[model samples]
Target: MLRSKLTDSPLLKVSRPVSACSRCRSAKVKCDNKLPACTACEKAGREKECTAANDQFARGKERSYVAALELRIEKLERRLGYARSMKDSVALNGPDEPPAGDPNRKDSMAFIRAAIHRKAVQTQEDADINTLVSDFGYLAVNTTTRDFEPSESNMTFARLVLAASTNEPVPTPRTADLPAESTARALVQFYETNVIPIYPVFPGTLLHALVSDLYQQHRRQIRSSEYWLFWMVLAISSASQSRSRRDEHYQHAVEFVGRALPHADRALRPGYGTQVQSLLLLTQYSMLDPAHFDSWHPIGFTCRAVVDQGLHQDPPHIQQMGQDALNERRRTFYCTYALDRAISMVHARAFSFYDEAVCVALPSPFQASSTLSGSTTAKRSPDASLPLFRLRQLQSEWYQALYQGNPNEHLPDITSFIWQKYREMWEWSERLPPDMPAAIREMLELELRYSYVYCIASNARGAQVSAYGKLLIFDHVISYVDRIYDIAKLAENAAVYTYHDALRVLFMGSQFVAVLQEIGDLILSGSSIPSPAPGKVLPPPRPVRLDRGTGDDLDRSVRCLERVKLTLRLYGDRWESALSCLKNFEGLSAEVWKNLTTRQAMRNPAPTGQWLPIPGA
Candidate 1:
């Protein structure tokens, strides 16, 4: 009688389908693919979370995920078109009879529908490409950039939809509450190695002192606002180094930031060492996160803090403080200056700290021991920061003259200044210690070359230069491209490549190379030729290699682009900009590839419209 009752159960009578919902499939459980939610999800009390993977399948053909998305996109596009037509009709033929629906409402809905469809397509494409390239080990799937300037009503609606669509709450990191000494030490080491060389905000001795205090449970020191700021700094710095642990570290950093924000007003008080240091760290962290892409805001606030403390000006009341205080003030001012220039360049904004107003000199070389404090006055330290700062100043000067120059006329007055700066950069490179690691040397060289490229590119845009100047600029640009390719290849080895390395330069260089390739393709296909201005010398045609084993210049250009893409993929986890730039490069490459291939197919037409494989194929 019990066997009969068990056999009669409806659950036993019905058989589950072979295919399952994504969640149930992953969990190795059976699923009933009900619309909107599955039975497995209902049983597990996760009905809302259930999502079928039907999009990965197709009827009457091999399943193509991209194809499925295309079908949905087409449907949405038609619906949006119909909605727009209705909206236009309502606007033009303002209803004689009361309308059934609001025209404005209809238009907004249509706009949002179309925008969401487009976003979905883009997201799917990015995911496909990211998955394809994941074997390279570091490329990230692109997400929508939230930083675009919106003006259209439809755009606002789209943004609203985008924000509303992602309702999942961000999980607060558990690591934030724990002060793991081993983790702290590892992060400190990462910060010192990868971050500090370029942006040396913390002195070694001071950092050591802080870490020691934190560990010793010295509540008197650790309870202060300074400790929180320092902790946040370490969190962000460590986060920047590790791709796998980045999100966790970032969450920890965010928690520390929350704790520290309440003390901002107090910290920003005049001559507060902890306040200035915290601001600097926060500014550096901002550059890594796309959510806070505008580094200028924080850096501006820091500059104001610096001014309030009179760090820009040499301390007039010199005898009151110790040597260490004076040195720190100088260091802080320069650090702010460097960051100000970087942010200005990135955002194309004006610098908050002007060079002429700065009277304080570079800081003396920092010593690791507390006992090594001495009055080193005007003696410039051999620290890399001093030379690096000088290089940045030169870059700033070139940027001002080139980027900020009048577009209508060529600024020849700064030509001599440009050469002088280049010469100085070259001399500095030569002076770099021969014992320097090959990777570091390459990094510095890339920096110098990028500056050179910028100088020429800017000058090329001006109307004042003669044809000869244009030719010279072209030559210099080509040289920069060649060097960029070399450096990009060098970055492939993970042992030498670091998250802290400059990716912006590589992105810019890739773009420049892509443009050149487009030109080469057109020229090769006889669609375009170099059109020089009056009395200008046309650039010589790029040499075609007789050795077919080594592919043409266009192929080489593509290879260079690939190298940059690979580097971006590796570093994207740590820096949002890296991933964002990767998306752009990939898009550009696809367009270029399509254009080139289309031109090639046209050149070699199929006989009578039916295709046949050529001898090469």
Candidate 2:
């Protein structure tokens, strides 16, 4: 009866506090322990800020409960250990009546020994389990499971938790600190390792997951300014190449930029300033992928924000970083160039919106009427209006000339306009005193060179024709070489000069020859003609070489082929040189020869043992 009464008593029950605050429980009426009012009072339209005190008594109770549980577990473990020790001692002592020379008895004893050992092991294991549980409370099981075999996702989660708990910074990967070439190589390696192998079997989700992981991993390593820019550029280039998977890559890259943009904007280093431009370029590239267009509106917003911010602020210090010192100005120039390219790409891709601005001259009749007076139009003679027609005719001619292989086609109207602009620029140059800054001179020179190259490549009669319809195409082969030569001559450092000179000879020189050979083929084929000479007798059209023997023509072909081969060798695995050569021979017959030779050399033995020398050798 006493036991029953004790069991039924309120003291025997485990009860928790009714309120977290003692003051609230003390009040007969419901009290929030807030400074002035409770939730009920506030809900009744009373303006009050709640100020509740922490329940110290409740915390003490929780601590005592946890301690008691731990003590109980420890006492149980100790009792189990003692019981195990007694069992082990009894097993070692064997049975009271020993069966001498009996194999069965010996086997029984061995079994008992084995059982004793196992029990000892189990006891130790249990002790360890108890210790772990006591130390880390409920986390012991999870920790043990993780330690057994951690998956990538689990590891990432663990790392995030650790970072959060300890407020630790994450380590940057080695590839993240590498140069542009190294970064590109790493990206290629990642694709080869992760993407290429499963490409045939897993065409969709798995491949996308791997690529997404790679993008995320790379995004994390972007610590330094250079690496960040490199990553952005590499991502764009990689996405560009991944035609089938471009949309997936584009989305991943957009997400990357979205996260990085805030950090990049706050960065103060000038060398790292290129990251803004790179991010802009990435946005433009993402916009080009149709799948991402709808989801990536933030790209446009970010780009405009960056542009607005950069233009409004002072120019970055281009000459600060050590490695950048050599090409500081060039890097700065490229930063601006990249921005322009991004803007141009966006304008081109989103044509419907920007097309009107670009085609200002082709305004609607109503719009033209609004801007022009009838009296002024009446005063202008019909013949005077002929010049406008003439300009259009000339523009069309220029377009045709550019398409064809003509090296000297000039659109009078366009050329005249360019010349007028050039004259104005020259006047501006002259107005600059002799003591103008070298940077200003260099800028003017670059502008002049760029404009000249633009005109030469675009105005050439056959330039557009052979360019295979790529707009704004030009013979950069010759101009690139010329610029390299010019830069080499002016370079003060011997190593820099040699590098530039070698690059020029290896890339530009070979490319110019290739294009010239292509032009020769087009002329010989009688498929096209050179531009008309100015006030000079037009050369009789050369007959097409139909049955051209494989003798001198073949020999010349072999030499041209050999020249390409030798140039490739001289360059020695130089991709820029090879790429420049390829670009120059874009619309040419010589490219076929070079490509075939290269392919054959890769697949089989070389026909000729001797390498050909550079032209004029």
Best by TM-score: 1
The Cα local distance difference test for each model comes to 0.51, 0.34
Task: Encode model 2's per-residue lDDT on 243-286: one tens digit a residue.
Answer: 23324554444444333332332221222343344444434344
| TM-score per candidate | 0.57, 0.26
lDDT of candidate 1 over 519-602, digit per residue (tens): 454434435334334222232233223235545444544444555667566556556556766777677666555554554456
Steric clash pairs (candidate 1): 138-569, 410-464
In candidate 2 the C-alpha lDDT for residue 485 amounts to 36
